[model samples]
Every structure is written in C-alpha cells, then in structure tokens.
Target chain A: MTRVVLVPGALALLPEYASQVDPVAELRAAALAAVRWLGPEAAVLGDTQGERVAAALMGAAGVRRGGTAAYLVVGNGSAKRSEKAPGHLDERSFGFDAALGDALVAGDLSGVDWSLADELWASVDGLRRASPLVSGSAAVDYADDPYGVQYWVMRWGS
Target chain B: MTLRLGRHEFDDDRTLMMAIVNRTPDSFYDKGATWAEDKAFDRVAQVVDEGAEMVDIGGIKAAPGEEIDEVEEKRRVVDFVARIRAAYPSLVISVDTWRASVGDAVCEAGADVLNDAWGGADPALVDVAAKHDVALICTHTGGAVPRTRPYRVEYDDVVRSAIDDTVAYAERALAAGVARESLVIDPAHDFGKNTFHSLEITRRLGEMVATGWPVLVSLSNKDFVGESLDLPVGERLTGTLAATAVCALAGARIYRVHEVVETRQVVDMVNTIVGRRLPARAIRGLQ
Candidate 1:
C-alpha cells in the first residue's frame, strides 16, 4: 500500500515569499494538512520550482524524505482561469481544468492532454509522473483557484 | 532590542508613530489649534483614530516666547496626560518638556515617556523617568539651553555630535535606573541646529540607529524641512515626509509627526522597500 498527496506549486507557499498578511493562508493550511498525512517520510515529485515548494512545505509540516512509497506530488491546473490569472483569460482553461480535476479525483490521469496543459500554463509534470501510483477515489481536501489559477489539494489512500 | 514604552511593549522590528499633540498656543505648527484642553483632547482622539501608537504631548512650545513656568507647563499637560491615559490605556503618552518638575508631575499623572526635547537641560528628568519606570527620549541639542534657538551653531561633524550627545544622554538615563529597553535617542532635527546641520543628521541617521538605541525622529513641519524646500509651515509636510523616508531607510524606530497617516505610510513604504518590512499584503505575482 502507498500514500500520496497532491498540492499546488504556488510559490507564495514558500516561507521566503511570505507576506505580512498571507494571501494563500487557507490554501497553505490545506496543503500542509494534506502533506502531513503523507507520513513522516515521503518522496517528492515535481518540476524544479514545484520541487522547491514541496520541500518548503515538507519542512514546514515536519515531513521528511526517505521512503518512496509515500509520494508528495506538486502540480496545478490552468493558470488562465480568469482575466487576472498568471496566463490571463483563456476560454480553454475551464474545460482543461475540468478534465484534469476529474482525472485527479477519479485517480486516472493517463488521458490528460500534456500539450493543452502546457498552453494553459498548468503544472502537471509531477501529476503526470505519479499517475501509476495514484488509484481509487481521491479524498479531495481543497479545490479552487481564487487567483485565477486552478489549485487542488487531494490525498490518495495508504 | 525590544522597546518598552511605559505599559506597552513593541518588538524590535516594529516601527512606531508618535503623533504630535501640542498643548501650547504658539507652537510653530498648528499654532493654538489644540491649545485648549478640550481641543488637545480632540487632537489625541484624532491621532488615536488615525492609528498613532503614541502621542507626544508638549506644553511649552519649542521656540522661545513668554516664559511658561514649571507650574504652567504642568497645568497644561499633566491633567491632559491623565485624561488620555484614562481614555486610551494602550497609548504611549509622552510629555515633551525639559523641566524635571513638570516631568515628575506628568509621570504621576500616567505619562509614559519623558521627551526631553531640549536635550537633557534638566538632568533630573532621567531620574524622574527612572522613578516612574517609564521611557525617556534622549535628544541631541548641541548643549543648547531649553527653549533657546540655535545661534549660528556649527559642528565639525553634526552627525557625530548628535550620536555622541544622544548616546551619552541615553547612557546617563540607563545608569539612572531607567530600563535599558526604555531609553530612546533622537537626533533632535532643527532643535539646536541650522538647516545644514539638520540635513547632515538626516543623511547620516544610520549612524545614530547604529548606536543600538531606538531612534525617534521629529521631522514633522520643522524649520529644517522648511529651509530645505523653501516652503512655509503648512507646505513643509512633503519635505518632512521626504526626510522621513530617508530616516526610515536608515532604520529610525519612532516617528514624531503632525500627520500620522502620511508619515506612517511613508515609513511603511520605505521600510518595505528596504526589505526591513514585508509587504502589508503582497500577492502581486506569486499567486
């Protein structure tokens, strides 16, 4: 049996980028709670920046790196969810994120369009790589893109 | 170092706003605007509403005029200090005077800080502060007598003189049984110096901050700002806040200002730019 948790690669979650009034307080709390369920030791899978965010969250949540069974994956959906999003408004974002979010909750991401995810500025590298490890219905902890970017915090079984 | 201003304490990284509330009728700025006790009370209320962490209540105007004796000074600020203390328990009430007699009177009335604006003219003020266990603002006036204007004062190095004099006064206050955290230093801009001296002090304020004592800058609508911009009293606020930004960059801890909102904004903005303060609520790009 393996445990897996997924969090957004939001740079604001990093300690060094913190603001006096945290903009991502709820998201960070959800991500941290999800990461903690990955157990004492977990393997991180993400792109360069995503990995840095994962490391910071692990450090904050007291999660260590050793065993590979407990996987902490960092990724997110479209950045063009709205006009103010990082990638600006893209009508394709809603459909793309909907498919991706469904795939994540259903625990099957093999049919995701990597090219469309890249066009929408979605970070799916870790999610794509961790496809084989995720199974069964995921326990969705958080799902929203308040900043025009899509973010989800979900955990797969032990 | 943590700052203990009477019953209140602040972390070292926190900056403070000490709004000016004049009880004198002839003060250089806002002449007679808040001279009436009720009017002064209103001023205190206004600053508190505007988020002033402290209020520097001055009885006698800084400039020379008809002699305001110790009794008159006490009559002006003591009851007012008690009134403010009763109203805003958390507010740091600073009584600005160089007379230890009036200092003692106000301290008994619940004043928190003894702002010796004349740069320790009455040496016993520290003793009074010590007895009350309150904070004292040790200022540098180049040994100028209380309520006397600077007469063509010249310093080989104005910043050096300010640092040396203010630090010595702080040391004296520390030795007089005042808590080390309760002693603050001020460069006393335009108090006993010409525009040039004041400018030098403003430019090199970091040296004063380097003394490890919290620095209180009273730059609001002073002569130095007027001379720097050739602006009149009402127009000098811009120049004052500009100088305030410079001092904030150099890490001044307390700002004595007539305009609390504007000064607080300028200090917060400058400190954020200097990386000493985090953005109030930043989500510009990392969202």
Candidate 2:
C-alpha cells in the first residue's frame, strides 16, 4: 500500500515565524506524527507556499523527499469561513469545505471542485495532483478550522 | 552572559522586571502605601503574581527628609528581605540602599542585587555585594549625595558622563571582587539629573548599552516623566511606559517599575519589535 499523509499549509508551522506559544500546536503535532509515520522517503506534493510548509514539516519530522511511491500532500480548505477570516466570510465556504473534507477523509479526491476550491481560497492542487492514486481509506489525526481556515491531518494506507 | 543574582540565574537575552516595593512612609509615589510590614508583604505578593522577576525593597525615600541612619535603614529592609526570600525562593531580591551596612544586612538576610541609587555613595557597598557573591546595580548619579535632589547639576555631556561614571563604577565593583556578569549599569534618571538630562539620557540610551555591560533602568513614575508631561505621580504611567519603550529598544535588561503589568507589556512589545524576543502567541495571518 502507498503511504500518504495530508497536512494544511499553515505558515505558523515554520520555525522562522514561530511564536513563544504554538498557535497551531495540535495541528502541528498531528502533522508531524503522520509525516513521521510516512517513513524516511516520500514524494512531496503542494503549491509553492504549500511546498515550503511541507519542507519545514519534513525537516521537523526528520523525514525527507526521495524516490518513493508514498506521498505527502500539503493543502487546506477555505480562508473565508468567518468575518475575521483572512478572506472574510463567504457563505459558499461552508458547503465547499464540507464536501472537500469528506473527499479527503474518504481518499476520493476526484470529486474535488477545483474551480470552487480556488474561489473559496482552498488549497487543493496537491490533492488534485494525487487524485488518480488516492484510493485507500484515511485515518484523520486532526480536523478543525480554529482560525477559520479549515485544516486536516489525515494518513492513508497501512 | 547569564545574569547571576544571588541564588537565581537568568538567561542573557531575558529582560526582567524588578518591581519597586517601598517600605518608606513618605516615598513620593506610594506615600506610605506599603509602609507597614504586612502591607509591604502584600505588595511583594502582588508584584510576584503580576510576573515581576525581581523586587527592589527600598526602606528610604529618594528625596531628602528625615535622616535614616545605618541602624534604621537596616531595620527597615533586613527582615523584609528575609521574609520575601523565605516566600519566593526564585525571586531576585534587590535592596535599594546606598549604605554598606544596609547592603551587608540585606545580603545576610538573602538579598540578591544591591541597587545603589545614589551613584556609589557607600564605596564599601561594592565590597558587601562581593562578599555575598550577589549582583550589583552600578548607577550614575553625577556625584550627588544620598537623598539630595538635583539642583542646577550641569554636565558637559550627560550621556558621556553617564557612560564614564557608570562604567567606572562597574569597574570599581569589579576591582572590589564583584563578578563581572553580576554587575549591571544604570543611568539613574532624575537622580542628580534635570529633566533635560534625563530626556537626553533616554534619547541616547544606546550609548550606555554600547558599553557591553547589561543596563538596568529605574524609570518608574520619576520626576522626569512627571516634568516631561507636566503630570503628577498618578498621571505619569503613560509617560513612564514611553520612556520604558525607548530604554527597552536600547537593550536595557532590567526595569525597576511600580506598575509591573504595564511595564512588562511595554518591554516585551519593544523587545519583540527589536527582534530580541518572540511574540507570546502570533497567529493572525499566518494561520
């Protein structure tokens, strides 16, 4: 089975921008655990900013990119889930994130509404890129949008 | 350079709050608020709860009043220091006295730093600090006697004079066997300094920080803050915190303050802006 891990592209996870208290502490812990379980080598899939978040998480988890069938996907849901959210409240964010999160946990990325994710500011390009091979069931270690930006830490495969 | 304040040790980059707990009946700010022993003890508990890393226990008011001799000053601070030590073992206990007898008595009672606000009035105070293996606050007072207000005390270059006098005092403390890391220099604002001198010191505090010795600032509700804003003691908190932000930017390590929470916020915010410290919990757009 192909090992796969999914984590949100939160800039707070990077050591350079860290605060004294971890704001994304639980999310970071879950991300690290899943990444560590991904073993020493895996293919990293994400956008430009997501790639940076992936690299930081990999370095922190002592995992690295190498030639392997396993995949580490970096992406997130909407930034407009509330009035205080970065993109402000967008009513479409609710239905969009609901469908997206369900698709991720079920490892069925083919149904992701790419155009709607872009409109809602959801980062799903990496998951979109891995859609063809994403077939196994996922175990969610984390799932929440504390800052109004939906984040999930899920692992797929044995 | 880790700070060694008697039994406690702090990291080099850490900025500390040294809350002032006056035991004087006529001190300008509190005006005998904590004159009684139990009231003073309550003040200690309050500052410690408010996150003050140190407490500067002063028995005598800064301005001239009734003369408090060695025996009287010792009587005022020695037991208070011992009681605070027994309660808060981790707290840095500093006794604000210019008398060697008071310093020795407080050190015997478990004091940490000797904050000589009179610019080394008692030369033997250094020896007392050395004898106790504690920290010493080397302050620059322009040769003013203890408890005397500044009267037309002019300086050719106030910052230069502050640097030279404070560094010289620090060296003197070093020669008297005080540990180099244990010595902190302060440009004692309003102590033998006019409003202009204090303002200049606050403006060019980086010169004092450039001397490589950790700087301690006692800008809490002082006359300079009052005179600058034309406000009374009760109205000088904003002014004091303004001066505090400047000193913190210039890399002052310890703050002797009356309002612990406000000063801590100002120092932490200023240090965070200057990159010396991190934000307590930043998660605005980075989430």
The residue-level lDDT of candidate 2 at B203 comes to: 97
Taking the tens digit of each residue's C-alpha lDDT, what string does model 2 give over A1-158? 88888899999999989999999999999999999999988899999999999999999888878866688999989998999888899999999989888887788977677788878888888888878767767898998999989998988889
Q: Which lDDT tens digits does candidate 1 get at residues B119-221?
A: 9899898999999999999999999988889998899899999999999999999899999999999999988899999999999999998888899998999
Fnat for each predicted structure, in order: 0.87, 0.87
Candidate 1 lDDT (Cα, 0 to 1) = 0.92
- What's the residue-level lDDT of B257 in candidate 2? 93
- Candidate 1 residue spans exceeding 4 A from truth: none
Poorly placed runs, candidate 2 (over 4 Å): none
DockQ of each: 0.83, 0.86
- Taking all chains together, each candidate's TM-score versus the true structure is 0.98, 0.96
